[model samples]
Target: MTDLNQTALQKGADRALEKIEIDTLVVGAGQAGVAMSEHLTKLGVPHLVLERNRIAEAWRTGRWDSLVANGPAWHDRFPGLEFEGLDPDAFASKEQVAAYFEAYAKQFNAPIRTGVEVKKVVRNAEGPGFTIETSEGVIQANRVVAATGPFQRPVIPPIAPKDDSITQIHSAQYFNPQQLPEGAVLVVGAGSSGVQIADELQRAGKNVYLSVGAHDRPPRAYRNRDFCWWLGVLGLWDAEAAQPGKEHVTIAVSGARGGHTVDFRGLAHQGVTLVGLTKAFNDGVVTFQADLAENIARGDENYLSLLDAADAYIARNGLDLPEEPEARATYPNPDCVTNPILELDLAKAGITSIIWATGYSVDYSWLKVNAFDERGKPKHQRGVSGEPGVYFLGLPWLSRRGSTFIWGVWHDAKHIADHIATQRKYLAYRDASQRSAKD
Candidate 1:
């Protein structure tokens, strides 16, 4: 976790650049990059890890103050290091998560140089490797692993009007309810962040309007096990993303205030006005789709389906898991659906802020390699890219549903490191064979 802000390595423009050669270079200090470094170290492979900011920068700066890991400590942690003194089912807070990563980096004295940003990476035309141009010195490496992670660019829909009275911010920018202006708040997107933010604002004595959309809702815990435990037992964690026709599922659970199942009906009961997907915002008027009832129904369906599967698994395996029938119960908020507010004048509703909880977009423009498709998605099997020695780690669905999590990225990194080891061996063997031929 060394800060090189005052050093020559941090100032790339003024420093006299020299060619630095290495066998492997990992570009990130987050979970993916650090895991990759660990694997390389185990293989006795020498590589340098470059980071634009300090270790676990995202956890420290990008997230809200009270945010916790969506997954339980036992499920999402890296191997060889257990989350100390915490219950297996308890969620780790953002600061604790950040500290864990920092400790992990220090455990092996990872070759991580913070304050070094990678601007561009391209194939070395003059040689058989890659030329990485960074904020620091340039490095020519036989292999490069782009472990920059999934959440790079935030996306906000361009529908809001110019309302100077209202404070608009993306969910990533939101820290807490006190950060917003004093008035009603509108939270767009019904994903994990959106629901959590809307709930928090409502609990803080603010009138909150939550935009509901297609989402998957599973119980926080079921039958004496967390929902994630069921997923693991069902082999869903190792499975790839479902077909396109299926629902677009983002994690909707919150580890805040002792996590509970996400329910629009329950939120509506708590006075958080649940509306349909936002249609537009213009001229101090906000309109929504007439599908509030449908959204609630959809979430209920997702919830029940998961419970049914869990029950079936228990019965089929002849295991003695409890049959908590109360988990299947749902109380409908008739006013929320029957009297849905499809439109509202911003001034009339007293709404003073809008938090866009829309997710993120992956940016790989700096990676100037033939490893992507027309849709800008990386083209590869697992983490190994089509371009030799160019790999992408810590991406969603890169290998399985778990690839987006800490443990999953570690597995992906190990695979990439093993591949690099094989490639290095091939290089040495080629030289030996050529010398033998000359003799």
Candidate 2:
């Protein structure tokens, strides 16, 4: 729900007011856009990247202060760059990751114009390309890669009562444990963000209630290798999103405390209360579904399935890897799910704040293209859209399971760059003034 609109309002007072034209206009300066810039430059395709704010703005501000990447540094990075002053297995802090992107862009000398807010993009009135209305002025480009990413805005469920007595905020706005009021905290989602935040609060001596939802609980390491490496080796990273049973599979892996398996039971044993999916909220009372047991069972199922597949793959390959028995060991179900409270009054429970760790809702209102579906999702094959010259990148499951990862964006950009290289406009545009309707 946040953008650098205020910064845009300040405007680029230092730059000139002259109009601009290009063959390809890259929208965003995040990992995706920067990667696109690298490949376009390598392929001799001229392009410009327009960013509303500085590079890696989200990693610097949108996430929590204590957050680290879910994947380790070695397996989660681009092909040629290794994180500085960090071990390969270490999880790079948010600050380090942001710094890496800034340095990466500088290394390539990417043609990036920061602080440029693209207000709207539509077909040219008198030509065959796009006319972009920006805060600085106007621009024309034959092709545009919408690389702003999918997590444009946060989405909080409408179940919570519209009351101001208790503080509430989306996880994107959360920075640390001390910023919240002194009392119990209710986090309504069990994804990586919600679970990690809940763990931090409980460790800080605050009561935390986590609403368990559907998520894949993969071990941080399996068969002497991290799950990220296994995914790459097993070709799961390139797995198609259209495959069955992948409809709702958000991984709950975390790289905290030197990286460990994601265990909700362990969280419950450590004093963090686990509850089922949040149902509704009245004046101050909250209702929860009586499905906590089912939720825990589903997580257990996912955990076992991964172990089983890894074992089978190892046996088939005849790989000599040490057996990690703890991953398959069963533990007793915690009391939170077995004898849980179906409803509770927030005031009586001493819960003073609520954090909604729900996922994001994208905003493509500025994209005046006929490439989106009824739900506003882009109707595309991989990154190629039904509407020509409009491509999407850095979106989850855009091409495969790893499409959302940083390295995935890098490799995916190469494909897009190669495709654009086939166009006659790649080397040079005909002219800046005369863009015919058929062009």
Candidate 3:
């Protein structure tokens, strides 16, 4: 039965590929792309969503099986489809999240063409629309929405030394400790991914060394509510202070302890060896910076700043919020602040594996237009690109702090759809006027 259904779907996709023109071409079928497609469908626009793989491919394959959403199920729902059959506060696993997106696409009957990898998106030289060359066929679209998401490619630093003797894997490729060879693991980058992977490895009874870097350390819950709830109340998610082209701080969330705070201090106390930023790797010797203590202090300072902002917001609004519980310093134990290990021999430490949780970079090489800036980042105003018919979605701070998250992309999607509709209407009126003048 499933095979028959797939066959019918493939035939329909083939027919769609034969089409020479479409109203809009959405170049992704993740949460962002499906949301955009749903809005476009409501606007009665003829559109197609192209996915390189299956729907929600990132959640299906990019993440580990045990990985769950950082936010709760309630907060991760798309428009019109709240998470049911699960506890609202429970963290949805990777499989569950993927299934949610799949269900969303099916529910809306989103026009998504799976396995259709877009090769290039270039402006049509002979017309006002764009010519999208995909693996299936060429598609001419009046407007193109790039919802390829924030994490395009895993970034490994150029200075990272490579040796065939050690097994190195990026966080994207890392599944679990069991997949790695027998030895201690050195996890680099102190962001969410780094901390989570380090914690997992440590819990697996493997000796884990976590490299501490600049990061934000917000408590998972604050004042009897989740930190995200307070952030929403304080309007921090929509803060105007977050400037464009700035690297955003990572929020550490750990489901291991029922969504408790995951920070360097906490990890240090959990028998995980905390180290400074990895500086270099030569031969079997790995050198680290002497700035772990400073980084931890910086993180604490940032946390304090967040609390101060929340307090000021409460005062200004005259809202009687619950006072914070007695303050317990995060790093009370002097041993938590370890003496920086400037250098270590990987072989001597029995560290056979290195997991680089260094983060991701956006790849827009397939987009052939002047829409990108010098930094190769799309130059756009709240999802609307400088190019008339070009738009972007799922970009960090595209519309707000929540723009990149599943919960916040609906607004940007709706805005983009509406903008496209308005522009097309104006174009139609202009064309009619020109024809009448000619007559």
Best by TM-score: 1
CA error at residue 423 for candidate 3, angstroms: 0.3
After superposition, the stretches of candidate 3 with alpha carbons farther than 4 Å from their true spots are 1-11, 14-16, 241-246, 311-327, 333-336, 434-439
Query: 1-439 in candidate 2: lDDT tens per residue?
Result: 0112213322433564246667788899999999998898787666778899989899999999988999999977888688989999999999999988888887777778888898999987675778888888887788889999988989998887788889999999999999999999999899899989999999999999999877888788987899998878778899876457756556688888888887898999999899988999987899899988887788888788878888989999999999988778765788987898789899999999999999897788888989899889998887888888888989888878888899999988988888888764533464433566456
| Per-residue lDDT of candidate 3, residues 293-401 (tens digit) | 8988878887777777777777888887788844335655346355668899999999999999988999888999889888888999999999878999998888888
- State every prediction's TM-score relative to the real structure: 0.94, 0.92, 0.92
Q: Alpha carbon lDDT of residue 106, candidate 3?
A: 81
- lDDT agreement of model 1 with the native: 0.84
lDDT of 2: 0.84
Q: Evaluate all candidate structures by whole-model CA lDDT and list the values in order.
A: 0.84, 0.84, 0.81
